[model samples]
Target: MTSGPAIYGNFTIDDLVYPNGSTRWGVPGGSAVYAAMGALLWTKVSSIVAPLGADYPITLLDKRIDLSRCRSIPKTMRNWGLYEEDGRRHFISRNESRDWTYFSPALADAASGYQAAAHIAPLPFEATKQLIEELRAGGTKSISLDMDDHDLLGNRSLKKMMELVSTVDLFMPSQQDVLALFPGKGPLEAMHQLRSLVPEVALIAIKCGAGGTIAHLAGSEEYLRIPAVHVEVIDQTGAGDAFCGGVLGSLARQGDLLEALLCGAVSASFCIEGMGFSSLLEATGEAANSRLERLRQRVERAPCK
Candidate 1:
């Protein structure tokens, strides 16, 4: 552990993937950027731990982003590809640019120290565990994880990733990613399968795109469904990450789960109004709270019982 505080997220990126041309495609996607910005909304200091190539931005650690911590390693370069249909998308990642060789606790501290909480997404078991351990050593607990990088249902290749799930406090995943990774039945069935797979997980949240999210954890089986605030959704790229960041960030800073979840949902809702994380990166906490208050009113005013 680096002996400091820093909100952080670890991810794997092949290249920047996003929509382009006639068809919605992924060009250069930035997951760390999205997650870092979202987490920063709540946690005081945020950092990033990931691998990139020479073109990868070593100076990025000190520039542009204000992560209390950040480390981008050099690896063979490549770009990520995305294929979107009807507001939904999938990834065809090639040349994942990360060198597990350089990722370490010392590096993380050197990047962003003296912060609170952490978010680990798009990162595998080893990386996630190492970072968590580092953060924990700094006297930080309560970490949130998005399981998109684990590849859970594929020939048991994600055994290690699955094992690491127990170490996290909040387990997050986009509904589509979970479905694709474990195709079968509906949401309840999917939750059941997930519970069977990662029983230690305190919560399992599935972002339902424009529909919001349904979550169950802490012995709650009612499937807490929180819908996204009605708005003009533009690029849905970072909605899931925003949701995770929103929830964890709020919880870490405010200790309010419902508010955190609501903030997350609102952030996600806001994401659809712009390309990538433009909405989130552009907005402030005051704006988020105002928007969240408005969304809550809509949720409450929604009639038909």
Candidate 2:
């Protein structure tokens, strides 16, 4: 099998608060970790560029993931995810007042000269744009971005978002973030609106949790909706990130968008089966391939029009 593309993103320590009055403190979680895990199932991860504090748990990461370029910063990205009984989730940054910027000469140097596909996980819009710009300049072939809810809600700048979208090959945003990005518009309408803004974007994947995923390839008139796989829900923390990683990794290795989407959907199914990365960690490539084949058959039976 061909080696997977080089993936890059940040690692974060998540403090999850459940409605049952229980808290899982300082758990190893983040877009980078989740994405890396999903990618690792298919191919080797090139490197993870993250800010690691002394308190961050390095043992949780799989040994196959490369972290030689990761930085040891004074503070790691930490956030509190509050799961309410009402089914609403809220994220609060524990280190909101601290500077979380990881862009530097070293970071740029580490990410530079990559000829493979790279996934830029959620971060500030400017920071994301900077990384994309650097990677593109360094001769990276394909790049994907996962838009974070915080960035969309905070920035609220359509122009900046469009600028960033135009630079990436794929743009994956959650349903909530898509709705938040364009108010008063339904999912399809919101996707269309985003397409209007960044018409040059090769693909726009809208992650509708539980409802499935809706994807719009550039030049395709209709959106392709992939039904969600049925599974017992545990924790939905890193599902989107996992999906992003799976899709990018598949695209990098296989170069098939449809197969990439299936990979993403299957990876997300594994994520929600357990809390954090537990289920995903236990998932095997053979199992993933089996699920992918099943999903492909489902898609074929009901081909997107």
- Candidate 1, residues 1-305, lDDT tens digits: the string is 23122334433333333455443333233556566556656555555544444444334332334533444445433435464554556544453433333433344452355445666666544555677776667656677877653355444454555677777778887776676666755655676677778876777777778666767765554556677888885667667776776677677778766677777787676666776555665677787778778766543212211
After aligning candidate 2 to the native by TM-score, how far in Å is the CA of 241 from where it should be? Answer: 0.3
By summed lDDT, the worst window of 10 consecutive residues in model 1 runs over 1-10
Best by lDDT: 2
- Model 2 stretches astray by more than 4 angstroms: 1-4, 19-21, 84-88, 102-115, 300-305
Report the C-alpha lDDT of model 2 over 1-305, residue by residue, as the tens digit: 22245555666777999988988987878778888777776665545666656666778777777766666776567778898774447767775523445522234643634547888877776677777878777778889888767777774678877787899999998888886688767667788788889988888998888878888888875678877777899888888888888888788778888778888998899998998899988998899988887788665222233
Question: What CA root-mean-square deviation does each model show from the true structure?
Answer: 5.0, 2.9
User: How does candidate 1 score on lDDT?
Assistant: 0.59
